[model samples]
Target chain A: MELDPKRYAGKRLLRREIPLSTTALREALQHQYFKQIPTLRKEKNILYCNRCNATQPHLQNINCQNCGSTHLYCRNCIQMGRVSYCEFFYEWAGPNPDWHIHNNPCAWEGELTKHQQIAADAIDQTMKQNGKLLVHAVCGAGKTEMLFQGIATSLQQGKRICLATPRADVVRELLPRFQQAFPTVTVQALYGGSPDKTGDGQLILATTHQLLRFYHAFDVLIIDEIDAFPFHADPMLHVASEKAKKQTCASIFLTATPRQKEKRQIAAKTLPHVFVPVRFHGQPLPVPASKLCFGLHKQLRKGTLPKGLLRWLHNRRNPTRQVLVFLPTVVLADRLQEEAIEVLLPFTQKILPKRETETLIRTVHAADKDREAKVQAFRNRETAIILTTTILERGVTFPSVDVAILDAAHDVFDEAALVQIAGRAGRSPADPTGEVVFFHEGRSDAMDKAVRAIQVMNRRAKRL
Target chain B: MNLCVGCGEAYTSRPSWSTFFWPERISLLCKDCEGSFHRLKDSGCPSCMKQIGSSICSDCLKWEKTSYQGVLEKNVSLYSYEPFMQDYIARWKYRGDYVLGKVFEVEFQKLYYQHFQDTKYEVVPIPLSAERMAERGFNQAGELAAFTRAKRKDVLGRKHGEKQSKRSRLHRLTAENPFQLLSEPPQYAVLIDDIYTTGTTLRHAAQVLQENGTDFVAAFTLIRG
Candidate 1:
């Protein structure tokens, strides 16, 4: 775009008035490529915006023409909702008629409303500012698209990226999709047994521990389910992230339920925020029914599925929809899995245990990989039902997934846990609905909190 | 004196870095212990634990726990290399899991408090090294150090190290040792390997730790053999 400006420097220049001679154009083009050198080392190109301050990544088009002052950081990006979904934006659409197949469809698909676009624009701004971003979308509101601009812009800014998730299963599921999005950037899917430095890729999708080796490594750090897992639990992981993070790096956190700390940041008006009240698919998350299944956990511990639960399973079983059984502990999952095999052994030729389980892989911490794999298996329609611990309660979605938390009253199924478990169902645009049941010995405070939160999110999603 | 806890085989209590031991330190062993160890050596058996007294002990000379003929160094057991040492080894591993923590803790506190009231030591619990820690969920010396109490304690033992039990005694001695100091490596240090059966493990720690700026690494163990 910058040809010999000297030709027009003394004269007024108009976009259409610049004329190029074939012989001279070649020489000037060479200068642009090789000869136009500045002797002084150009300081890292940093743009400052008055509104967001010099500390923040400067937005490309700051203080839009409509709003001239720089205080333009959006307050809508940091809200947390009940479920988390990634936005998928693509160039070609009508070319593939069946493209809208994802249960949790991204922003690229479906209707791109003005507000959704605004959210995307705001995220792009955050990436430019270069550090610490929060998305504040509501339950059912599509939260994924708000991230596309930030992620893409950061990569454009030449920074390596790792989309860390508390759920290893989520990471596995995300690999193919993110790889699809960022084809040119080498994306490494790392978790346990991550082979040593084959070579550093432009982007690395890893668990929190895998990030221990990296600090300031990524230009953009997108932490999905930041409020979940060892990411929130371990200080060492935090230290690793701090070490790996480049100074003034871009960090985006996507969580459905905004924790108290983030809420404070939003209320204090220190962080840029964006909120999508309505889901892009135009439907609310499903509400789970709560009940006391009467010693449901005891039956599981005894290595037996409860008689009532068997009847309930039969009632929920229909070839039309998929079911997910959520438990509080892996020990219980083993017991329930055994019982399911014994009961269903007669009808099916095979009973594949939850394959792709990150949670079951380790005896110590929840196997986030196996946890995500179970959900994926459910999504692929290979497993009729997947059993899991409370790790699956939040931050994962599968369309047409009907969820039942056996032993829902276990302290593990707290209010937050219950809401998240129930939110798993009704994530698909095609079905846009599903059933959720909390089968517990007795509804605990967590159960009450879970139900109330779901009803609240439901009420909120409706108002939007 | 470098006494073998196995049979109380005491050699010099100093760094033996002559041309003979510099490349290899078989001379560090007392005459009695050296003869006894060599007498028990068998073919291809490197580790003393694996020796049948053939030519080179099958286990000690072969390597740490793995690696063929890669035992980093030789160890001299002062007592019955097998039957006697085996008993206490089992107790230290199984029965003394928590109990020995107290023993080590009391010993650490008493030793550190009484002897060196003025100086400081970042007590690095002899790493079972990495191989042993992996095989045994926790390192014995590391665990003992965790339970061991002492005055003026600075975070010690190792945050990281090489897989010692994974390789042979010879490999460890020859290959660059892998013991890291988590704290600011002290000028004067104390290495607490589980046992002093063969000074191989301690020597490796001392070498590597010293390389990282630790001085006077008084290699300590419950038993010297």
Candidate 2:
């Protein structure tokens, strides 16, 4: 059976993923449009995976089960189909996908703020020039809206566009918004278990992990959350993003907090950038206040909320406002939830003498089975307080909620996480001054940097 | 930091008295991933180890009525083929994540010692057909057999046919035996496989060994569905 060239075009897929016999694959490769590359490239003693661009350390030698040979397979991308020495990654070396140029593709009716408009225009210019640009906007600066004009213009020019983020939740959240914004365009979202396997969409929204399946598939590759986990930390993800885009494609990085390397590049004027300090509502970012709790971990270990935390919860400026408590780890969050339900709930109930029914305090973590339901319950005001780990630090919003980070000095709560956690509050214009407090045993350098970063952004917003 | 082969998360093994001397014995799976696999209970059929209380299971009784009667003396499996094992097998075998097979090495070795240590049985992993071997790159049973210190003998050869996983139970039971003895059979033989679904594959291989004058044939599988 002959394989369809169109279906396989621009896709770097494993041999098993492609449904073609060896002879059929060989016949297809006879054409100038088809090509098959070795899955693992040997260099001296090291092996590199061509699919995920994983190198020596991420590749391990294994006894090949099917071939009975000792071969190196990529451990980095083992979650995807394992690519061993005997395996080959097939690709269609045909022409680039010809996208349909539609007129006025964007259906977004909302207007971008003046700050957003500037970044949008700069993004348009950068996309036109096939250049790199960093969109360092505040968390609530409407970063998605700022990309509409540039993306729409690119779509009108019949170019394929990709918006890759590090987190799957962000990909899910952006899918509907982008679909509504450009109803005429084909927008496909790709993640680990996503049903859409075809890489034929004109505009693809995917987690960075999904980018390994594409080879020169996009004309404009916009990476959202550039400094997020697994993206900034893994060199393989960076290589995947680079390999996913065309040689001359425009690469736009969107991040609220740029990493030190990117910051250095921007400062050195090697990379062009646009910074939007003020949010769409023109409000300053909420600066986190630090309160030193002498023995935070000791109190938490003893299964009791610290006095400073209990006092803060009791004396909240708006007692009706919901509270989000961020713990350093899941175990701590679970432990505190039990203590909060028993001790903190009744204490708050005493403060609110009129309310008779008890309020709900829930704990949520990445592995929580009912994480979506619990988060939805909090959104519906069914749950008054939520204790979570850094999983909820970004990509989620709740209106009029005070943020508190217990054990802020813990290495888990880095500068980016602290800023994003603080950003979670003050998102709604109706309550733009939500309180953010860092209840720590001793202030770490990350805590100090985060507080100073917020103040700097606020100061910049005032100058604007 | 050690990365779990089951779920690619960085984990640090807790320092215990065992680690104080043999610190190089790092675990390949995290606590949660290791806990997901369900071990089979001892209270099962004595023949095939299916959870049907003490006596021989119906499948074993039916196997006794066939021409290959009394071929398989006993079969012992380590896991119960739970939902987690399904996914684990899919990733390790079908997806070809070879390192994932290492996640079971220690446990499989312990199970092997418990069942087959006292006997002098020749370890023979169920061989894959040449086509399937070339396609999958390695036999899963072959990798599992390596966990034990026993020398594995490749004495049985399989014919190319449809995968047993894709076949219905009725078809599997009625299918022709695919095993051919490659050399003289050992007096005492133990067949190693990744799974024992209907036990037809093992029975067919055991029948070939028994026909070749092997005194006893026992099967050791990772999962018993």
Considering every candidate listed, which one attains the maximal lDDT?
2
Off by over 4 Å in 1: A1-115, A138-142, A196-199, A317-319, A344-379, A394-397, B1-225
For each candidate, C-alpha RMSD in Å?
19.3, 5.5
What TM-score is obtained by chain A of candidate 2? 0.93
Provide the TM-score of chain B versus the true chain B for each model in turn. Answer: 0.47, 0.95
Candidate 1, A193-239: lDDT as tens digits? 55533214666787765654443355677787666765775554665
Model 1 chain A poorest ten-residue lDDT run: A78-87
DockQ of each: 0.03, 0.47
- DockQ value of candidate 1: 0.03
Residue A140 CA error for candidate 2 (Å)? 0.9
- Native RMSD of candidate 2 (Å): 5.5
True contacts kept of 2: 0.71
What tens-digit string does per-residue lDDT give for candidate 2 at A1-464? 34544467667888778777777777777764577788877678666788887785578878865565787888788776777887778788766555789889999999888999999999999998899999999888889999999998999898889999988778877889999999999999999878887767889999998888888878899999899997999988998899999888999999999989999999999999999999888989988988889878899887678889888887878777788989988888777776688866754453334443444778899878887788887777777778889888887778778888999999999999999999988788788878899999878999999989989999988987
Off by over 4 Å in 2: A1-6, A20-27, A42-46, A343-360, A380-382, B1-91, B100-120, B126-136, B149-187, B194-215, B221-225
